[model samples]
Target: MQCSSYWFCPDVWTAVILLILCRFRGCVSHLKINKYYTIKSEMAKDFPTRAENYAQWYNDLVIKADMAENSAVRGCMVIKPYGYAIWEKMQAALDKMFKDTGHVNAYFPIFIPKSFFSKEASHVEGFAKECAVVTHYRLKNDPDGKGVVVDENAKLEEELIVRPTSETIIWDTYRNWIQSYRDLPLLINQWANVVRWEMRTRLFLRTAEFLWQEGHTAHATAEEAIAETEQMLNVYADFAENFMAVPVLKGVKSPNERFAGAVETYCIEALMQDGKALQAGTSHFLGQNFAKAFDVQFLSKENKLEYVWATSWGVSTRLMGALIMAHSDDHGLVLPPKLAPTQVVIIPIYKTNEQLAAITEKVDIIVKNLKAKGITVKYDDRDTYKPGWKFNEYEFKGVPVRLAIGPRDLENGTVEVSRRDTLEKSSFQIADIETKIEHLLQSIQDNLFQKAVDFRENMTTKADTWEEFVDLLDNKGGFILAHWDGTPETEQEIKEKTKATIRLIPLDARPEEGRCILTGKPSSRRVVFARAY
Candidate 1:
């Protein structure tokens, strides 16, 4: 019974009969194998190469993957269903974290009275250029009858400015509530949209209208407010590192970059693929500036009246931009498993409706088990798209895991699993596939974070001399650690010469004795400088 080959076997009839039986049983698997190879060949040509043009590749992937698109309004974008779903995942995770940390959510008005802007001189100066004014309350028919025009009679006694930030309005309301120190720490967070009339904009990075959560807190002492500010900054850094899988540098902003009217600003800065820095989130210590402006005085334990100390912190849709640039590749977005909208997508591969139905039955069981474990699974059983097309679509959309179940797989008690991060395929026994996938998702999250951390370390460099700084900025382009003269004038001169600004004075930077890289003046510690978004 030693058969050498099917074509040249001494027991040719026996071999032929065995082959025929195998073909009849495994025909679906053979067909799918062929289809998978064909799909891989076509996927190579679908996206722009990152080395060729990173910006174009990013723009193409955002739209092709159904993430977002420019809206009809001049500097805004409409987040599509897929993009919004990912954002919702982010919101859910962060919301839970906020609640666990003793914070409460509240709503605030979108419009601030025009007079409120003038109350805080420094805050107004910082945001004056970007404020959008609403002059009238209603519109009336034009005399020419072509279109409606602003009605002069409908003008309000005072105009309103669409809120660029909630500090002024929140502090005004807080004045009435803070008569006594029992209301010492007012921990309120509002998830709302704000408007700023930007001259230039990008989708999530800078838009006229954007969604965000702003936390405004009122405290009785300056120390308490500062503690709250630092606490929120740490929370943002943790979320960015653990959930978004993006490593960040925690630091305090320079005076030039501090939030208007705030005494100090704490921020988390992240590096992008193109050697640029992005401010992922910010927390500001207002130090009673807004409280004094709005007359928010609290009676202290010593029976003395004092202005309340304050802090305001926020992270917006801009985080969406940071997430996209930090881990994505030329192939498309590579989302962290913790933040992927659909953690698993099951695609059935079959030639006919009957085959698909059989495969779907097996997939349904897996989906149910995964859902029970809190994993989001999407069973793509659409007849309009082929299995190959569906695979590519989910890959572009950054689904963390993809499972393929066909008739052959059903018979073999196995399933094909593909990871979006590495684009590698493997087969797992169906006996405990759900548990295996849960472990795989965790591994994917850790792997993405490690990869980003490695990239950041590679990109970060230290420069001791002006020549080295110039070369790094011109060619290497990432975060450059260098000593500064500790003057805003020196910082500006460096920016004018090299277009690289001091991103931050890193909170952990050790004091070192060295001359300034630009001015040769005695320096205390190095600051992070980079071309940033």
Candidate 2:
């Protein structure tokens, strides 16, 4: 005899046995299943490989790893707790660096008077397209009483522009703050959110609203302002390389790519795993442009009144996107230890309560010791999910290190350790486990940075002619060092043809004579070019 539910029961006898068991156990009541099974092996089946679809793989990994998701509002995202935690770590580290550099934190109004923007013509022109304006202040009930409507009677006499970038408004305020050379070099940094009405947005990469830190400084001399600009660029490079474990090339932007109204723009560009470049951070030397526009005059030590020299520099949440693209793998994120919120996770494998309790006791000691060493550790001993499920969760989320111990291991006084960067696993004695893990975390951090450095070195190449440049960009897709005629027209033409732009002119670039790859005109030095994010 055969059962009607053949999938569940292969024979009538099996069905009878299940029914009898159900009578006593109530079927599903005693059986526990993990809620995240969908994201485990089941979702892995549908996960796109990086080579198959790099963009889709990134989108899927962010969502699957519980990092972030698209919000209801268009061109915006809801960063999940896990994602925000990582961001918080970045913010804390950066804030310390800013304070160490003689910059004090301050706040500025989010709504700038429309007239303020008009003071700097080029600044306004650069951000005009992305500004969000507030016209009316109050909302009133609809006449039909369905919903609220903008109150026509309450319209503001002067329109306000949402802060896309804070140059205009900040400079306007500086006019009143600077009266003498003693008041010069007002180094202020603001950690705040700004809105830019972007038409196309990607999570953490480009969004309508984002959080950042902007530093605005006033100097009595042009040399002082230029020094400030370069100092901040170095700060950004240090944070990117040491904290985030991303290697970057320090350089200056071309005239076409310079920040609007800036005399010079300095930047750090990083190479991603997909052979694309990302501008990790930027600093701009305003060179008295904003001060002159807003009439922010300071009395110099020489007893002459003159416009103050200015510098403004910033780094935003876009670094999150860079971190993801640089180190994550097809399985999920391969986070560096310095930036991983949970640097280490410990799980216990057990079939019975007694066994679990024994493992937990040993894990508690390890956790305390690791925390004393200032490590962020999580000991997940939830019984609702099996040990295997938790292992997959930590692996996918990119916890730098993981440890598992069971009754057998407890008896043997050993634990199995696994590292996310290499997916390498080994058994180790439980004695001095915390010391081993601390060393291992540092090893992982160093290993990840070295791996990225190796990748960038292999991907970067030189192109001496137009054919070589185009071929490298089309097929090779990394940094292409090529000659340009040092003209905006030639740069624009190159972009129109190949969809690639100059990433930067290396700061250390020597004066090598060559011909422009496109125009065959005389050129000074080779600039780094690539298709970018």
Candidate 3:
């Protein structure tokens, strides 16, 4: 008998009969079937929108884009190759800036003696809770053979503190390296990993261990050291604005918010899409603090001995989190053209080998031209995945410009271009396509930066009274420009009440007579306050 319905075919009827017989014989006591089932592609799963769940959306994007993931070690992360490539780009740009400023790269030991921390009392107190200490030198097999255990007999005479910041150790080394007026200006930078032992950790934002570059400079006078500090701050701001395409506010940190042993802390703060601020970078003026702590002194031009002035500045992988939150949408990452690892991706669509060969032949010329123009281009001609899959993959990975050429396009001597920033697609003649792609990339970068700038401008607002400050923080959730009494007690009180802290005191803030928003005390100028990451 022929089946009339597609769902109830002859095979279906046969299976039904077999099931009935098996059930009657108690052979299939519990039988179940799905009327219909559809397998969803992993790449097709949508992320939670920012409005729905901003935190989840960010976590999903980071993992889905193959950027990073939590590692076996708690509070630590494994930065995948794709994420590291972006970081490498940032390092390259900033490294050149450092070199231009007469800074040379150097290496410092990872393990610092516990005594080193004791040299700087405030520094030790600041990092004591977060430090990871090693008391034993070796581990031995367990007596029960379950696992290994720290060998008590192998304990060291002095415990070692894993380097949190290299101020103490770097200053100690500087003492030996500098002794006279000729070795006055010692500019050095080190690229290394540090362990902070954070209690709460996010993938890249607050990891226990992360990668960073710290610059430690020693100068003959305090004026020169301050100049170096400000110069590095500008470098960070430039890198953030130009390469990362994230707008930032340059300013000084309040005493409570300043870096632990620094006399003054300068920072560039960037606002994220979720209306929270993230400190993008910081440059700290040490003001002979470390030099005095380590007894690092030099012979002056007047034949007198004096302690050297010092400065330390650094930006960590937390900038990765800033980059992700600043501009990425719910769809996926929208990388700036300058920092995108694979800036241009070319995908060929074809049904047969001959067609693919023809498309590839054309793509090879396009790739060659793009490479000659110094563009990082990828030609994805793999037959394992369909054209649609490849398209979604690159889009999610934030490839700035995507070019697709099918047989029809090949015949017409044109290619379809898609810009990731806007998800806009258009067809253009393949003639001089290299120049077109380059211009499109620049336009995307500019658009992303402007969009961020506009968002920040809209989110920033002024609050006059304590009520207004509390309302703005609880309801609007952005940077609030308000008068502070310039006292740590008031800062602490505001934080305790509203969970908002002063983000920065603007460098160019004009002198405007005002009253403190919280205490109604006299104030000089308004400070930027925000709930930050």
Candidate 4:
């Protein structure tokens, strides 16, 4: 029952007071802005400035937009269709990759026995607070006929907990499946739901229930497990950069931030427009924790029982939040071509059935060709809405490329193509439409990744002193790259004061000579630190 009930408004006092005045005066100055966009956001203070209020901006975006809503239940969200569509696109892409990587999809029970969670001490402890346990099944009506509740007689001997992660339960079953070394490398990935109760919930960012894929691999040795972790991490990084068009910092989580019961945790971190960090994905090298806990052993060459090494990695619906903030603009979302459900959409503008019929006929031909090439194409022929309104709707939904065909195009043999990312429009001959649109989609994807990378490069700052570090975090805080002295105390101290933490120790951050900004202890290299999702 413990869940994040509400979020205290973290906006500045001046901004809050201004919104009050503007509400009555109809003046945006009260909201600290010059004018209003519509009504609510007009004076809402340009995303609260990442340096001044990073967390607030994230909250504002989630609630202001119709992406998602906080549920009546704590820590959970009611994802709107628009938001769910984005996640569906992400799932389609990642699922295809998993299948291509020699992995089989499977499902596991949502409720795990409470004792099953305790099999791995660290894992259980880490997730205990967030777990939702089921104690009773059936409830009987009271004599007063008020409300029916759980029936005590129907209770089971072992209580069930909503799974926070599936490692323990998955491994417990694997023991029965693995009889020899032939079943050593078990490649299985499951697209499922997980619950992790949070003290605070923000739409897709940290909801109690999220949809994700958990890839579990049972390897014969530690080396194989490590290899699998790195491989999947790379796969995630590649997909994020190319398919989702998001630039990410692939890195290893520090011991404190690492996944519970994992030897090493690899992750991909993306910087949002708010200059805060979001962990887009994580891969863990779980040496032998689950294997030993579940007694999953194999007979080696010498006939001795040897523990199996395992790896589990995942990326969740939270990536939808990251994607929205990373590339989306004031208008709405901007989807990359690969992840977009429709690579191209044809909106025919017309005044009559003759014109409409002509447009639909030609659009049908174009769609046929696009489909022939295995491209996803959508044709909007709804007449109830005006072409302009439809344009705005599709733009908000982030269709990668929009193709417009008017009656004039029929005579001229040309169509207008617009890219959602850049909002750039171009005219093309009808014959060249297919090839050009394909090229434009690829170009848009590349441009988005490049833009994200450029932002990350520019926002990353290096601080040599504690004052400088704190100042940067207070002012331009994105990713503060610096030496950590590699201690937990310093990490805690920084987070307490600034609400920022070591997001990750990047995989590519080269060794450098420096002193810890907080501890003044000797250090070798810089790690990425930021306020994170």
- Model 1 stretches with alpha carbons more than 4 Å out: 1-46
Model 4, range 100-198, lDDT digits (tens) per residue? 888899999988888988889999777776776777654455445554434566666887887889998899999998867877789999999998765
Stretches of candidate 3 exceeding 4 Å from the true structure: 1-44
For every model shown, what is its TM-score relative to the native structure? 0.91, 0.91, 0.91, 0.87
Model 1 Cα displacement at 149 (Å)? 1.5
Clashes of each: 0, 0, 0, 8
Residue 19, model 1: lDDT of 9
Poorest lDDT segment (10 consecutive residues) of candidate 4? 14-23
Q: Write model 3 residue lDDT over 1-533, tens digit each, in one string.
A: 33344443333112100000111111101111111112333554776666656777789989999999999878799999999999999999999999999999999998888899988877877777777777766545567655455557766687777888999999999989999979979999999999887767888888889999999999999999999999999999999999999999999999999898899999999987777788989999999889999999999999999999999999999999999888776568889999999999999999989999999999999999999999999999888999999999898888999999999998899999999988889999999999999899999999989988887888899999888888887777779999999999999999878778899999989988899998899999999998888
lDDT of each: 0.83, 0.84, 0.86, 0.79
lDDT minimum window of 10 residues, candidate 2: 14-23
- Tens digit per residue, CA lDDT, model 1, 309-356: 999999999999899888776567789999898899998989987988
Residues 1-533 of candidate 2 have per-residue lDDT tens digits of: 22233234332111010000111111110111111112233435577766666777778888888988898877678989999998899999999999999999999999898899888888877777777787766555567655445557767788788888899889998899999999978999999898887766778888888888999999999999999999999999999988899999999999988988999999999988778788989999999899889999988889998999999999999999999888877668879998899999999999988988888999999999999999999999888988878887888888999999988898899999999988899999999999999999999998888988988888889999899998887777778998999999999999888878888999899999999999999999999998887
Q: Cα deviation of 213 in candidate 3 (Å)?
A: 0.3
Please identify which of the two predictions, 2 or 4, would achieve the higher lDDT against the true structure.
Answer: 2
Q: Select the stronger candidate by TM-score from 2 and 4.
A: 2
Candidate 2's displacement at residue 450, Å, is 0.7
